[model samples]
Target: MTEQEYFTVHHQLTINAEPLPEGSSLPSYPIFESEIPAPFIVASEFSHLDMLNDSARKELNNSDFKHVINLLDTQNSKLNLLLTFLLSQQDDPTYRTITSAFGASQCTFLSPTSLNDGQYVRIKLFLEHPAAAIYCYASVVECQAQEQGFDITVKYQLLRDADQDLLIKAALNQQQKLLRQRSLDRENNQ
Candidate 1:
């Protein structure tokens, strides 16, 4: 698919926080709903329902939970960064399947949740597929609510060379289209 079809310049805003840390029971955060304008990088055009497991789906459906946010950053050749967000406490899983030209080594989760730095979360992904099933762990780093959804910034912690190569390929193919869409969005917003 063309990058334009996969990405938009618009932001989604919401408020809900759930904390799931390693070796600890899940904790619930108070649900706060609001809208905020934030920038995002769309990683794929695929739907969330396609890649998630049954448990993930149920967790994502909660009222405090919001939609997932995806972002892609292709800066390094060895690793491409894919960032995703679970906007609310509602339990609706986000899932996607990617075909990789290069294979991945490992995946890691970063920070869990934070109220500062504009609702940020970070996850490091490892790839293991030519057509592989990859599981990612994400920790919240910062969060805030606005007019659209929740504004967030996330860091990718663990990535391998194969993961990087696949991201580079996807980005190279989509860069032009993504740029065009960004331009269009700018004009519309003004």
Candidate 2:
């Protein structure tokens, strides 16, 4: 038999060296054995993944992140958005103006007076350029109402890919910049 085949059939046994006491009220135990299963051995040969560093693998597991920027509405020649999040900070509303293959356009407004958690809002977005006037609608997915304004997440129903790309890029860019500034401020304070 091959070494691997012999190893597969071999069961390592361990036994207690000490003898039981005379007249002890105990049954004698012989041995303990273990056989490594084929599947387990094969699994052990695979490399473990570091999830933190695996952005592509992580993205695959997060399909919801891909759909987070769905389209909300479309009208006239313009487009509107139903973003996945409401503007969270006073300085960071989750909308943007972009220049794309479609030309200069803007995601111009969100609705609902307040952004408290569980409070829903219908957003109105406008696309102004190339001939003027476009509209879209969105429903709030998540939100927090504060003293100044509402932080919200809006989901778009029918916005186009190009427009959605613009919104996502804009939002992510703003968030990254904000995070960087905060980190800088912390370092400066320290």
Q: What lDDT is reached at residue 14 by model 2?
A: 14
TM-scores, all candidates, are 0.29, 0.29
Model 1, 115-151: lDDT tens per residue? 3432222222222111111222223344556454443
Q: What is the lDDT of residue 122 in candidate 2?
A: 25
User: Given candidate 2, what's the lDDT at residue 45?
Assistant: 23
**Whole-model alpha-carbon lDDT for candidate 2:** 0.29
Give the range where candidate 1 is weakest over 10 consecutive residues by summed lDDT: 32-41
Q: Please, what are the lDDT tens digits per residue for candidate 2 over residues 40-106?
A: 2221221111113245545654676543323211221122121111111111133322211111122
